[model samples]
Target: MANRFLAGYHAAFNQYGIWLSVPGVDVTASGPAANFLLRPDFKCEQIIISGRVAVAAGFNVDVMLPITVPTKRPYVQFGVAQSGVGQYPHDLSMIGTTAQIECIGGCLFRSDRLTFSNSNASGFTFYYDYLVFQRGIN
Candidate 1:
């Protein structure tokens, strides 16, 4: 199972440049926000992301992933680290969420479009620091 999982992951990386999520680790989410260059051509069963980034309220943070790997519903998992200087850090996790995959051009795109007015009232940014994913049985 592990080898098969890695095979799928490697395939995704080679084809789409998407990286497997390392739980509790934050990747650089600066300039233009962070991007997972997932080409819609490749199919994936699941995607997991765990990381930290700061995006002002009303501002959008985008991450790309395969909504559906062929005909299977993609599962997503995330561990988010919300933090700021002098502010308490909080953790949030979404174990699994089935995505409704749709395509426009040739890519699967998803953006964190929620505006946390109360949280960002002080210009606090949302930081994610952990990510992990797995592909479904084909």
Candidate 2:
């Protein structure tokens, strides 16, 4: 498929490009692998994967991706979202939750997965929304 550029000022000034899946095509996961296979013609220099997961305290959560990244180390950004008394997104001044990518002693990333862990032992479940950006995809 051809790459489509954004219209208007951004396309003219920045040349921002976007890719869309072809119509009538199925990219869903199949078989034992359970990974969504990209179209053979799909190509891009960068891809962003975003999702939300609930992580239990003192436990690790692994998220599997549909694409195999070019490098084992990709840029990751994440944040915890909670709603309750004295918690974030509800109480603005509270520092109630903390999380981190387990890179030091845990699996941070593989070619197709990302692992996240938190140090909070309050027995509270944290809902984390993360974005994984990988460049050099072709």
Query: Which candidate's lDDT is highest?
Result: 2
The 0-to-1 C-alpha lDDT of every candidate, in the order given, reads 0.33, 0.48
TM-scores, one per candidate: 0.32, 0.45
Q: Relative to the unseen true structure, what is the C-alpha lDDT of residue 22 in candidate 1, on a scale of 0 to 100?
A: 33
- lDDT (Cα) of model 2: 0.48
Write model 2 residue lDDT over 23-97, tens digit each, in one string.
Answer: 433223111212223322234434457767776777889999666554344567666644333332233433533
lDDT string, candidate 1, 1-138, tens digits: 111112222332332123322333222221111232232233454344333455554455555442223333333443333334322222533223253222111112233222212233444344543233455332
Reference-based lDDT, residue 60, model 1: 50
What are the per-model C-alpha RMSD values against the true structure? 15.8, 12.1
What's the true lDDT of residue 28 in model 1?
25
lDDT for model 1 comes to 0.33
The model with the greatest TM-score is 2
